[model samples]
Target: MSSQAPPIVDDEECRPQISFFQWPDYVVLALMLLVSAAIGIFFGIQARRQKASTDDILVGGRQMATFPMAMSLLASFMSAVTLLGNPAEMYNYGTQFVVIGVGYIMVSPVTAYVFMPVYHRLALTSAYEYLEMRFNKWVRLIGCVIFTLHMITYLPIVVYAPALALNQVTGLDTYAAVSIIFAVCIFYTSVGGIKAVIWTDTFQVLMMFAGMMAVVFKGTVDVGGADFVWQKTVESGRAEFFNMNTDPRERHSFWTMTVGGSFLWIATYAASQAQIQRFLTVPTEKQAVRAIWINCIGLVALLLVCCWGGLVMYANYFDCDPLISGKVKASDQLLPLFVMDTMGSLPGMPGLFTAGIFSGSLSTVSTGLSSLAAITLKDFLIGAFKMELKDSRQASLAKWISLIYGIICFGIVFLVAQIGGVLQAALSVNGMVGGPILGLFSLGILIPWVNWKGAFSGGIVGLVFVGWMGFGAQVEAALGNLSYPKKLLSVAGCNCTTGVLPAPPLPGSYPDIFPLYAVSYMWYAPIGWCITTLIGIAVSWMTKFNDPREMDKRLFSPVLIAIMDKLPLSWQEKVNWPLKPAKKEGCENSGFEFEAENEKVQKSEDENTHKF
Candidate 1:
């Protein structure tokens, strides 16, 4: 197989390069946009007819279907980066990253049992609201700020990545691609809210699956078969899975991928506003649990296909390395380049693949916009400023907020394109903040003794420590002082001219950076979690721990309550356990409290509502 095949190798033998992008391609791409926009318009009119409130905009009125919400959850987390980057990851580093799915499996139960119950009881619009209920306004404000920064940074990269893919395939300018796609995303998200985002995601995820499957199946067939692809990848030393090295500095080891990756995903699924909002769309805790596990199954499946796709790419280019051959300028560009080489001859197939990449970007960007609007409205305007407004006006403000964020993300896309190298570092740094946020939530829900002071202090310290480590590591890599040992690649069978090939695999050598800075990027979250938890516990004891009985039992996870119940009577008394004495109602929080918490919280919120 010639890896260097171009769209127009010879006019006589091959179709014109112009025919590579035919009318059918544009039609398929247009249908994807129209369908996404129509979903938003449909929901927008429905909401207006009912005079839907802010809650409806943020959480589908808490009446969403489980399967759509499940698809939405999966789509929100799997962005253009995952769609493009995962395969490249496998091609370069081997399949050790596939074990990350195991982490997803481990965290599903934790997200369901530990975090879902608390969020369901609180009936939160913003996940940060739990920070206020468990800690105080200061901690909540900090959390809201971190989330805002994280989303703003992340959303640009999400939109920019697929824009790059579009640029690679269609000769479209990056700016135009970002503008067109982001405009559609913002329109649907602003007008239709969470309902629009969820339905669009469901539609787009199917497109994502179809597009990726096309690439995998077609690429595999062209390369020979699944067995050939597998054998080639294994011969190339890329079929690795279990790497038991315990060294934190070793990238993609079994320990880092599972334990550290679990903490990272737990933070995402259990604490991030975007995902928690998805969980809240369901009506019951059981439905929410079911939705999360369904998301788990879908995520694992998507990851396996992506991993397989990487092996297929390797097989096609085993004798002729694309990067070294200068057929693709970057590793991320390899997938799109390969698509054009193999599938460009088949009209709408190329468009479907492009739409799939764009769909990944669209789903994530829309999700981020919706989450940003919800967090800004609930955490800042309502909670911090105490700006009470009528439900209708609140809904209107949320739409405006969503629109503003969409524009901001679009503008930032240009900046991201300018400093492309830093995107990976920015992503790593996002995890640094994520771990502390997860720690704060974990403390609030699982540890009754942690107080507001402890949470605030621990979060601040953890952020600083992780930030220091992440920045130092990124700087070293940029300076060519840090590098990971990748599986060997060759261009020995190339029929065309080639550039300098990468060095063959070398015995691993530790980077001479500080020991802590040498830790694998995968372990960043685990490090932050440890720092935050240890400091939180220490600070709480010094400040006199929170009284478990004084706090709402609804704030604690059922798992913690069960363990508290089994404690020795003396230990229970010493720790002020039993939370609050069970009434004749029979300690429902102690068992399985399915009902919404006392309506007093809602009553107070309603009383606080102000007319426009």
Candidate 2:
């Protein structure tokens, strides 16, 4: 087979070409940079003055308010994926992308009630620290390792999505755009700490909202109106917005999204270290719960706006398809094409959209970089190396780690080109690690008898199975054998006079037959979680290895304890707490007598409480 590029179809001839930005767009770019920098510097000064300890730097000294926390969560989750990819997804696949919001809405309660209390009670700096207290040091280490790997693979793509938008508008190369954006993000995150990240995220969220709203409003006006757009979309059969039936094979059925997909959102928002770390910034669990609700509402609103933007694109092009216009070869390029072509003559509009895209990208990248640094320093470095640092030294280490990870993430952005659609690629990569991580965390929280042996074995097995399933699906899809639907092209606009495009050659090593791709991406989380938890529990029960006494009482949910009580004594004994007599008088204080020669245990507790 020849390695030449595929021949362009006649319809592709009308595709809008993007040229270099003119003067007004440059002014907009300059203003955006200046504002972003100002936000960074202001936060940095505040962080330096207020932060005296590692906690202050990593989690805002555990004193953030609901609005800031909600905004940070919104910004972190939105990312360039939502800004750029959502519109693209909508343009390509209609309103199916909106299904993501369904899962997100249902998952918030899980974060507020189930996950928030455990992390707050423990006063954990990193979510993985819970694993250590609940199971063993090895379990914590595995969780950290998986989280780090996921972020490393995931963060670069976050950077790349916006860079694609900026590249289209400004004619800048992807690598250069990625570097500039990463630098700005690192500067803000390193200087301002979590406070800066949250406050800046709040601002960026506005930018993102404004940019999308601009596209929606102007695009609608230009296309005649909302009614016209709706009619056109319905006529085109792209208005099938709701799918109420249950179909495991269908990607965006209402049942799958609300049930199975909710698990994925819960895994990320509630259990993922990156998100949990954000919630830890709040002063009280009440504030954290409030923040979770705020985030949920905000996310739903944002998703509606995103879906609206998609409808705007379809409506604007109702009479003239961009594909028919030859403005772009792929549906993924439709949104950018619409902006550049329809609004090109209008000054600074392109720049605003581009800025919004970058805002989303930067928000996510900064959070990922900061979280990776904190996790690396606290979970892996301190635990594995048996090294301890004072508050001052730990804070310094965190700053430097953030800087280093920024560079590494910038490097990884190049590989994002290999992935097809931004949303699908992001979710696919996330699921491979997220499923196992969620399984491990569930094992720790809900199953008291999961010993280190079972936990470790279960985690590894879960990771391998999830990876195989996710990657196998990707391979099948690439080969066009998967049941997932491809974008349909209209034959009316085609020019058959040109020789039919030669069939793309098959890979030398192809699967003999396409396996049934019944499992939707949304179900990956629940399926993986079920597999891992069941395997862990069964294996632990068979081995009778975990000593319940070793498990921390605080980590077990009431439901978990009920299950533990029902197990046989031999199994229960292995994992149950041993009985002990109450401490007498000064004996509890004997261990720490160096501070005070013969203080009573109650006195010591009183003194310690008073000191704090």
Candidate 3:
């Protein structure tokens, strides 16, 4: 009586329903698979017909053009993580994520000017091999290990997230989705090699851009207009264009993301085996530089689309709360939900979006699988087995390795699903592994005084330290004991509970404690580098170890040469130098002579003998 008989609510009014999929969505999903398979098969056949050698398969015969190389790089870098994660980032935290593009932009110029020249000049198959020339075999091995670990952990997450998205749109099982995607990718990559990867990546990149623009255009129209949507976003405090104030504890302050993130970007693009290997596929430094600029422009344009897509999500849910409406359960599903709800009725629209997602995911997975196989074959298998695959058989081994690695990655995708927040997890793992590897490479290049012993020791210590810090933060986050430090706090914005419900409650609640020691993810690279270099220099002084005098000059940056020249006479001059130069002029050159001589003298009497 007091409640007026519970308002006589009807069941239909009490429980609202949302359409998950339509016929058009299924049609789009089918088209996505068909197109991806067609591209893969076409390239796979082309690669087999070419009978591409190992070098050709791994590095595109070192003859890639500027446009294709640039497009491949862009496609590889802008995976589903960028396509979906960046927008989700803006929707959740604000526009601070755009600073990532700034860091990426800065990295491109530095890569073109500083890193590309050295990498191109070396013509290395694996970037880590340069470490051997700069320092020692151990340094090279360590670098390869780090790259292997980083790729294994990082690439799986990239593969899995997009599969999850596709699952939402296509109603396919996540594992089935992952298997279909990777099988197509692996088949093409195993057969076609890098040339196949490059050409396919170019097509995927175009699809990515087209799909993203379509989403933007459709979203803008759905939101009433671009101006109205942007205004609503601005008023909601999601369209923050700039935030210059520095706060180390913040996830992304302007200075933190700009300066610190730049170093991380440098590590990934300039020093990483994945990106460096791509650059080396081209024949010359100039073309590599051109590719870098092309990628830079593409990156900026792609990020703008991603950020705008986030605003579209906000605009679509401007009045209604999808979370309350039961449209979706998690924030990750927001964009997919929006696409299905807004454009599901249109012919080919849902398929276009699905195709775009597959393009992003498969492009990334294929590059990763191919690169991982190449690195493993060149860096680990050959190093350990002492067996040489002849030119005739190298492509066969590469193809087999690509197949194996792709399968491994496909399995790892299931594991990645157990982890949360694809972008953050990917970056965190990358920082932990990539930072120390970058530090080691930087030490080898920029600090020549860091001898093999010192470099090895410093790398180990840096890896341990960064691992502890990153893991500790992750644990604290899991325990619900982490918070933004007071100094990092921004003004409170609209607490919109749209599209997703609040995260499920934990087993036990704990007091909120701000993480004062937390630093921006971007800072990890520079910090790790600083730690490794400083430790290396100190350890070198203690141990009195110096690089061999005959090491290649290309391995040392200008700064390192200056440091070496300033060092006073010490044991370095004695142990690292020959007592007398050979009678032949340029006999001591660190080129074919050094390699040939070392190989000849070091090889066992056995005809099959080989050494790394």
Candidate 4:
């Protein structure tokens, strides 16, 4: 897995290897791996000292500061797929893509106020536990299945993208890149649990910034300056935005990026278990809100940087289009190519970029593997089968489960090529998983009438509908039967003396005949969400509704309780009066009680002590 200078081309026909990586890059990469593993080992000793209570191992005893938790959440969500894909998006489509950030205008409030209040009140190990409490076990089962599918599908892209970038730039073998990164990720995550994951994520997020900033500064300087890059991109028609198109078929209009993209955000940021798991890691609701703000603010800033990185790429390749000239096979390759070409002038900078790419990749896989294990153990094995292991045994089993998921994630990388491009593939799969969960959970919060049957039926429909529409269009795009508009490029000044000129461009194809299939991928989450909510409501009317008197108060929202309280006594019974938590005394306990398991381990194995 050690990095080595790749074999150079011997023939004249072979263009000179422009970015051959050297010894310093390998040294930097090794240091990054060592630091990550060391964090795990440090946490391992801490666990041994305290005999590692369940709370400490799983949720940092709910005592982590807001900063690293925020950093971990951001790194977990932003893959190298995003780090590289965003800039390529800016280069090819222009600046209109940045409007996707506007979706957060609603995202911050909705998650902090609506969703956080519920999850924060319930100190469950897995968010899917809410499903069983609100609806029934079957509904909980569906949520777990889709969430498992979503994470399983997503981590492969995280695994593959950085490997692809590093392989192209440093001539590092793709297999070695995947193997080395995941091995380090698995080692840290399996040994350290949640605390190690959070701290290492903080360190990796720093590396990600260092790597990206290195490319941005060097590339910007090489392209003259940020002002020149902007001027050239705008003049060349690569800078664009605010096209208020009403049609849903247009890929990235303000309407689609904001109106449609908001659904994508709410679904993932509010509804997905991967994120909720982080929210529960905090001790208090206030810190949870604080962490959410940090992630939202930090993400927009990073996106702006990646956007500028794209402009720098366009400026540097202004006349010598790498894709057009066949210097790279895909647009995703452009970033690594730019980094290698520009940073090759320095000794260790290329390694820094390589470490940065792997940083995002490793963080993503580590978080996914860790969270999936918790879900598998808590929601599936323990909740479903009533596995009654002692706390120490459960913690040990979690490590084994994490290792298994790491192995599965690595294997999936080989099959992920057919899943679509990096960014589109991730968002579409997330949307498909996220939409139904949002619908199911929204029903739990808003509609007390929805039972297990209704949620189950509605969720299945949302999953099928979103999957069919999203994946169908992705297939067409993959086959080249579907394509998006790209800003024109010219290679007139490439300085290539030998190879023949790029082939002429292909003509555009007709739009898909089915309007549903042609709708922007950004809209898939919204469409699936709407379909699920509507269908769930309709199904509730047709089937047996839950007797509200029999239900637990924690299943409903405080907003609903507030509205019911103001109603007159006559109207109150009509809407199911005496909901348990409506009483002043009972209402104070929002069911966020962390009920520690009674089963105990030997003192030597699990000395549960209050920690600093």
Residue pair clashes in candidate 4: 121-592
lDDT of 3 at 587: 23
lDDT tens digits, residue span 1-612, model 2: 222223445544444566667788778766776677788788677666765578877888776767878888989868888776777666545675577677888888777876677777556788887777666777888888888888888988888777777767667887888888888889888877777788888888888888888888888888888898888667655665567756456666666667766777888887787789988787566677778898899899888888788878866654445554455555556677777766778888888877788889888887887798789888878866868788889988888898888888777778766665777778767766777788888887776567667788888888888777787787777776553432222323334222322333332322334333445677677777877888888888888755545334446554455566688888755545442222222112112111112122113232222210
Compared with the true structure, what per-residue lDDT tens digits does model 4 show for residues 1-612? 111212333334335354677888889988999999999999988888888866676777677778888888888878798888899888877888889898766788888877876776766678888887777778888989888888888998878888888878778688888899889999988898899999999999999999999899989988798889989988877666788877877777888888777888888788877788787777666777788898898788888889889989989987767765567777888898888779887988988988888899888888888789888988888877878989888888888898999898889888985443688778777777777789988888878777777888899998899889987887677666666757656565654433323332332333755777777888888888888888888888798676676665655776776787789989878867757632222222122223422121112112212211
Per-prediction TM-score = 0.91, 0.85, 0.84, 0.89
Cα lDDT, all candidates: 0.82, 0.71, 0.70, 0.78
Report the candidate with higher lDDT, 2 versus 4. 4
Q: What digit string (tens of lDDT, one per residue) describes model 3 on residues 169-277?
A: 7667878877878877887778778877888888889888888898889889977998988787776666655776565655676787777778777887888877887
TM-score of 1: 0.91
Q: Highest TM-score, which number? A: 1
RMSD of each: 6.0, 6.5, 8.0, 6.4
Model 2, residue 158: displacement in angstroms?
1.4
User: What lDDT tens digits, residue by residue, belong to model 1 across residues 272-371?
Assistant: 9999999888776667778889999999999998888988999988876776655666678778878888898898998999899989999999999999
User: Which regions of candidate 1 deviate over 4 angstroms?
Assistant: 1-20, 418-427, 497-507, 581-596, 599-612
Supply the global lDDT for candidate 3: 0.70
lDDT of the structure predicted as candidate 4: 0.78
